[model samples]
Structures are given as structure tokens and as C-alpha cells.
Target: MPKSVWFLIIGMLVNTTGNSFLWPLNAIYMHDYLGKTLAMAGFVLMLNSAAGVLGNLLGGFLFDKIGGYKAIMLGIFLTVVSLIGLTQWHEWPHYVWLLTLLGFSGGIVFPSMFALAGTAWPEGGRKAFNAIYLAQNVGVAVGPALAGIVAEKGFDNVFEVNLWMYVLFFFIALLTFKRFETDSVVPKNVVSERKRITNKASLYALLIISSSSVLCWIAYSQWSATISSYTQDLGLSLKQYSLLWTINGLLIVAAQPLIAPLVKRWENNLKRQLVFGVVIIAISFGIVAFASDFKMFAAAMVVLTFGEMFYTPALPTIANQLAPKGRQGFYQGILNSATTVGRMIGPLFGGIMVDQFGMMALMSILVIIVVIAVIPCLVYDRPLVKRSKSTTVLE
Candidate 1:
């Protein structure tokens, strides 16, 4: 493996290990352990998600202006501080502020990571990125599975582990910073012709698709937010819930590497894959609404994982394909922002509908949103190709 790839993997592992507990249990801790209501928990997540969206946008701007390693190191430090706060503190107002900080800081890490990967191998950024993607899924799979096992001992145990995870990430990041500085890898201006294309029409169409795609993720994100509670209401244990997360992670690991060749085969036409992802996610969540048995829920998750496999890799691929030269980081940041949008709004949307009308109603609404998101793929088909020797940006 290349040194750069190792850097990405180690960074991802540390980041995700902290994220494992933070994401799955954050809301649960607020609502169940800390005595906040479900709506209140959703609201806190909403605030965090909103912060994340802004962070993605600003992080992109920072990456574009300042550079990669500096921005990412700052993000890692902030995240570490946030984790420490969450582990030690328990008050409502303080936790809310910490959650906001965590979301904001965590937001910076992703776009910077993607931008750095894109810059490091200007020629094969996407393929090299596939490795980073795989590493992330591995971390995702491990974090929740481990969290589940520890949560069986108690929620505090989970939080304690997360604190250590952040400490691990902090030191690893320090090492990563030194490694990047000493390494030969640096951003190269390989693209001789610099073009700047800002198609408002296309950008609008993309955001519409992005919003809808985000809604599907919102639907998927519910499995962690409310679905676990729903399963517990149905009498499942933490171990069983962990099994579900384990299945989701394994699917991502097994599926992501396979996605690279297919994406390559599809080349710049990754929008079609994005459409397929939305469709699959919609179907899975729709089924989950009716699931009464463990097997049925497992089947729904399998379908959901298929959608994830298609969508997660394709989002960045499409962004890169559409992005102007020298601005891939900005658009990738935008792509990260879309996920934050979905996460921020998803909890509120899912919580309300599920609280009022139940899971079926929530799933129905997500299906419509996803269908609406797919419409743009029909008309927005041009790949932002580099104009060999020209320096002008065009449609």
C-alpha cells in the first residue's frame, strides 16, 4: 500500500472510532439516559446537523483558501475537545453546545480529507479515494459493533470507550501531520488549463437532487436514531441491535471495493448510480416500516446497504466529474454538506412523522422525497471534461 493510502486509512480509523459511539449513542444518551424527551433529542441532533452543514461549506472554503493538513489538524483537535466534553459533562445546555462543536469540527475533517486525496493523486484521485472510502466503511462497521458490545455493559462504558478513541485519534493525527509534512506527496498543478464553470441552472438541479438524496439518508439515519428504540420496544436486546449494525458495516466493506470497477465502467455517468441508490434506500425503508421480525428487518437492512453501496461512492464521483478545475475540493465539500443537510433535517422529519403517524408514514414521505431527487438525473447529463489545452470555462 502507498504511504498516502496508509495515512488515509489510519486517519479514518481514528476518526471513525470516536464517531462510532458519538453518532449511535449521542441521541440515545440525551433522550434515554439523560432524561430528555425524544423530540428534545431530535432537536439537539437537528442543531448539530445544521452546524455540520455550515461547517462543510466553511471547511471547503478553508481548504480552498488555506490548504488541507492545517485545516484537518484543527478539525481533529476540536473534535477531540468535543469528545472530552461529552464524556465528562452531563448538563443539557453544555452538552448541546458540545454537540454543536463536535458536528462543526467533524464536518471540517471530511472535506479536507477528500480534497487532500483528490490533490495527492490528481490523475487517479477517485480510485485512490476508493481506498479511503473502504477504510471509512471498515471504521463504521467496527465502531458500532464495538459500541454495542460495550453498551451491553452499560451506556457509560460506551462513553468511556469513546473518550479513549478520541485520545487515540488525537495522537494519530499528530503523527499524521508530521508524516504528511515529511512525505513527497503534495498538491500539484497538473491541470495546465484552468477553467471556472458555475452553471447556476445545473447547480440548482444538482442541489434539488442532493436535497432529495439527503432525505433518503435521513430515512436511513433513522435506523440508528429511532429504529433501535423501536426494536427495543419490540423486545430486542443491545446485542441484537449490534448485530444489525454489524451487518450494515460488513455490507459496506464487502460492497465498496466492488463499486470501484462498476463506477469506472460507468465512468462519468455516476449520476445514474446515485439515482439507483435513492431508489434502493427508499425501498428498504419502506419495507422496514412493515418489518415485525428480525429476519424481515435484516432483509430491509441488506437492501439499504445495497443503496448505500451505490450512493456513498457515487456522490463524490459525480461531484468530481462536475467540478471545475482547481475547485474539486469546494464541490466535494458541497457534497459533504448535502449529507449534513439530510442528517440535520432527517431527525426532525423522521421524529415528527414517526411520533405522530408512525414509521410507515415516515417511510412514505421519504419515498416521495427520493423520487423527486431522481428527476434531475434525467436532464443533467454533461460531464465537466477538461478542455485539453484551453483555459476557458464553458457549459
Candidate 2:
């Protein structure tokens, strides 16, 4: 990787670390400290995620118009302001407003970071995105662990720590981010590009994969929302709950070598890999439904991480493969938007289930959803197969 890509990766690491400190604990703080119901916490998270979705689009626009350096710097500045306010006043509506602001600002930072990574190392292809992904997991691993320890003192300390991490990120971006010579060009002629959708089979496949991605994200988002609070109700330590995330993030980074052979075996069989993942994830949820101890939950987390290892990357890879030459951005956007929609809905959905039907019912429903989601992976390419056969007959 280029040095420029490394800087972007480092910036991403810092940015995600700062944000992770609060996100994993958001529901816990709201439900336990503020006495808000789980459903209410979910509503707040949905609002935050919706704000983030908007910010994501705006950030990409800014990156095209003003280049990544300016866009990212602007995002970092706004986030700093939000965090300062959060540190000062985090009660009721104030916390809600500040958290939403942080989400929007932080969202603005991300697309620029990922886009910058790609622009900086266009030759690196998926490696650039993978590097950024790895950095994010690393941040997730480090942030929540530290947050749990700091939260043992007070959540105020956690907020302060979050602020400092962003402050450090700001400095790093100020000194290092401007070095890249990125091309800032606005996307144009969408109407002209619409005519290029001659590959209907691929388009359908991408749509199917995108739909599955939404459910996958919804299932995954439970960890931070309902599951976080669930662990607390069982008398688990905050550190224990956060450690699940730590294990999750670390395994994503550290277990690559361990799964390399299996990954290589299924390199061309993405659908198979995805089906296996969905099954593994369903199994994990089944374990969680019966889990009564921290160790049991930790084991579930490990299994969940392994499941995501297949499901997460495969979705994007499939979208990328399905995309036509002039429509890569559009296809990727569909996948990303679906994931965001899932995140936006997941907390609220999970919270409602737990509130209405209880944890057992919630877990049962999630497992069923995961099991059903495999149908898309299995059949996403059927149309492609049909088209290939027809074209062969014609030739």
C-alpha cells in the first residue's frame, strides 16, 4: 500500500475509535442512566442512523466538489464541536441532539476517508477498501475495551475520552491528509448511464444481494442495541459486554490467517460462502437465546464474528462483480444504502421485539430471519445462469 493510503487508514482508525466509544454504549447509557425504554433508545439510534445516511451522501458530494482533504477536515471540525457539547451537557434531549450531530458529522468523515483511500491507491483495487475496513475493526477493538474501563469510572469520562480521540484524529488529518493528490470530479450524465443497464441478470442479482445485506446488518446491529442491554440485565459487567465487541473486532483482524485456506477454497463460490455464513449466524443466535453466562455470550460473539467474516465482505464483492463498467458507483451505492437502511431500522426493530415479545422471542425471530435470508444468496445468480445459457444457444 502507498503511504497516502496508510495515512487515510490511520485517519479512519482514529475516527472510528472516537465514534465507537459512544455507539456501543449508547443504548446502555440511555436505558440504564436516563431511564428511557429500550424502544426509545432504538428510536434515537434510528434517528442518528438516518442522519448518518444523509451525511453520507452529503460527504460524498463534498468530496467530489471540494476534494477529500477539505471534506474530511470539515467533518472532523463539526464532530469536534459535537463532542465538546456532549462532554459538557449529555442529559435527555441534549444528549439526543448531540448524538445525532455527532452521527451526521462522523458520517461526513467516512465516505471521504474511504473515497480518499481508493483515490490514493486506485491501483490497489479492493485492497484499499479492505485496508480501511481492517482499520475500522481495529478501532472497534480498541475503543470499546477502553470505554468499558473508563465507564467504570463514569460515562462522563467516556465522553471526554471520545473527544480526545477525535482531537487527536483532527491533528493527524491536519498534518498528513493534505498530501494526497486526489481528483475531485462531480458525477454527471446519470440519464445517459441509465441506458447501460443491458445486463439485467446482473442487476437482479445485485438487488437480491442488496436485500439480503439489509437483513444481515439488522441482525448484526443487535449487538450494540438490544444485546448490549440484555447483557446488563443478566448482571454482567460493562467490561464483559464491551469485551464481546473487543473479541469481535480482534478476531476480524487476527483470524484472517486462520481462515485463509477456507476462504481460498470458496473464492469463486461466493454464494456457497454466504449460505454457510447465514447458517453459522443463525446457529450463533440460537446459542445466544439460551446463553446465561458471559463465557457463553463470548463464544457466541466469536461464532458471530466468523459468520460475518463470510457474509459482510461477500455482499460487497458480489455487488462489485455484478456492476457494469459505467455503473460501479451506482451498484455499490445500492449495497451501501441497503446496509444503512438496515442499521437505521435494526435497533428500533430489536427493541420493539424485546419490549413486546421478550428476548427469547426476539432471538427466535432473528434466527429465523437469518435462515430465510439464505434463499437470496442461493438464487441470486439463477438469472445469470439462464442468460448465459440462452446466449450460448444463440452463438
Candidate 3:
């Protein structure tokens, strides 16, 4: 990998580390410490995710128009400011407002980071995305372990730790990415009409793929929202809950070496890989429905982590492949938006279901939704597959 790519990875590590401290605790803190109901906690999270959707779109546009450096810095600045305010005033409405702003700011950073990674190592293929994904898990691994300890002291300590991480992240970005430049303006007439049509077809496929991704995230996000609260209701400690995430992150990092070969083997069959992974994810949730102890929850998490490892890296790689020249950021932004949309809806939906119908009902419904998502995943690339077959015949 290039120096620039490594820098991006390091930046992601710090950035995600800061973020992981807060997000995994958001639902629990709101419900337990702040005296909010699970349903209300979910609503706050939904608002946060909605803000993220806007930020994803805006960041992508700015990355295309201004460049990654400026766009990322802008995001970091906003996020840091929000974090500072959160440290001081984390009461009810104030906490909600700061968290929403944090979501927007953080959202801007993610799409830009992914876009920069794609540009940094265009020839690196899945390796580029895998690196970023790995860095994220590394953050997850470190952040939650430390957060678990800090939360033992107080939730205020958790917020302070997160604030410092972002401050470090901002400095890293300032020093390392100041000269970063990847944006390019493609000439309108450079491509013939036929190639333009091809680009459009590719984009359509990407959108379909993105839709499937959204559904997958909706099911997956229950871990942080309803499932987190559900565990506490089952008499699990906060330390145990945090430990689950630590286990998830450690498993991803530890298993990546073994998983990479399989990923390469199926590199040409991303759709098949997605379907297989989604099945595992759906099954994991079914297992969760039966879980009555921390051990069973941990078992479900291990399965869910495997599924995530398989599919998560592929999403960005596919987006990078489908992106037209000068629009990598925009396409990545769309992909981020899809994931954010799922996240935005997931908490609220899960909260409502659990509140009204109960945990078993929510789990059953999620499994069904995930299974249905496989349809779009399987069919989204029909156009591209057809084009490939036709080209092969012509040859």
C-alpha cells in the first residue's frame, strides 16, 4: 500500500476508536442513566442516523467539488465541537441535540474516508477496503475495552475519553492529509455515447446493490439498539455488554488472515458471497431470540461477526468498481447513505416491535426481512452479468 493509504488507515483507526466509545453505549446510557425508555432511546438514535444521511450526501458532494482534505477537516471540526459540547451538557434535550450534530459530522467523515481510500489505492482492489475495515475493528477492539473500564468510573468519563480521541484524530488529519488531492474532472466528451450508457447501467446496478445493503444493516443494527437493552433486561452487566463488542472486534481482526483467501476465491462472485453472508446474519438473529445468558449472546455475536466480515468489505469494493471517473466520492456517498438509512430506521423499528410485540416477534420479523433482502442482492447485477456473457460470446 502507498503511504497515503496507510495514513488513511491510521486516521480511520483513531476516528473510529473515538466513535466506538460513544455509539455502543448510546442506547444503554440513555435508557439506564438518563431515565429514557427504550422506545425513546431508539427515537433519538433514529434522529442521529437521519442527520448522518444528510451528512453523507453533503460530504460526497464536497469531496467531488473541493477535495478529501478540506471535506474531512470540515467534518472533524464539526464533530470535535459537538463532542466538546456533549462533555459539558449531556442532559435530555441537550444531549439529543449534540448527538444529532455528532452524527452529521461523523457521517461526513465516513464517506470521505472511504472515497479517499478508493482513490489512494485504485489498483489495490478489495485489499484497500479490507485495510479500512480492519482498522475499524481495531478501533472497536480498543475503544470498548477501555470504555468498559471508564464506564465503571462514570459515563462522563466515557464522553471525556471520546472527546480526547477526536482531538487526536483532528491533529492527525491536520498533519498527514494537508496535501491530499484525488478529485479529477472528467471531460464530458471523453467517452463515446455507448460508454456513457455502460456507466449508467453500472450505476443502476450499484443502486440495487445498495438497496440490499440497506436491508442487511437494518437487521444488523439491532445489536446496538434493542439487543443491547435486551441483554441488560436479562440481568447482564454493562461490562459484559461491552465485552461482546470487544469480542466481535477481536474476532474480525484475528480471523481476517484466514478469511482473506476465501474472499479472493469468491472475488468474481460477490453476489454469491453476499447471499451466503446474509443467511448467516439472519440465522445469528434467530439464535439471539433463544439466548438467555451472556454465553448464548456471545455465541450469536461470533456468528454475526463472521457474516459481517464476509460482506462488509465487499460493499465498498463493489462501489469503487462501479464508480465512474470523477464520481467515486459521489457513489461512495450513496452507499454510505444506504447504510445510514438502514441504521436510521433499524433502532426505531426494533424498539417499536420489542415494545409492542416482544423480542421474539422482533427477531422473527428481522430474520424474514433479511432473507428477503437476498433477492435484491442476487438480481442486482443481472445487467452487468448479461453484459459480461454477451462480451464473452462476441469474443
Best by lDDT: 3
Q: Which is the winner by lDDT between candidate 1 and candidate 2?
A: 2
7-120 in candidate 1: lDDT tens per residue? 877788777766876587766677667887666777888899899888888777777766767777788888878877867875778889988988999898888777667666
Off by over 4 Å in 2: 184-195, 198-207, 318-334, 379-395
Q: What are the clashing pairs of model 2? A: none
Cα RMSD, model 2 = 3.2
Model 1, residue 79: distance off in Å is: 1.0
The sequence of per-residue lDDT tens digits that candidate 2 reaches over residues 159-264 is 9999999999999999998988476564474633223333677888888887787787788888999999999999999999989889988999999888778777
RMSD of every candidate to native, in Å, equals 4.0, 3.2, 2.2
Score residue 307 of candidate 3 by CA lDDT. 91
Question: What TM value does model 3 have?
Answer: 0.95
Estimate the TM-score of every prediction. Answer: 0.87, 0.88, 0.95
What local lDDT score does residue 387 receive in model 3, on the 0 to 100 scale? 60
Give the poorly placed runs of model 3, Cα more than 4 Å off: 185-192, 385-395
lDDT of each: 0.72, 0.83, 0.89
Write out the backbone clash pairs for model 1: none
Q: What is the lDDT of residue 203 in candidate 1?
A: 54
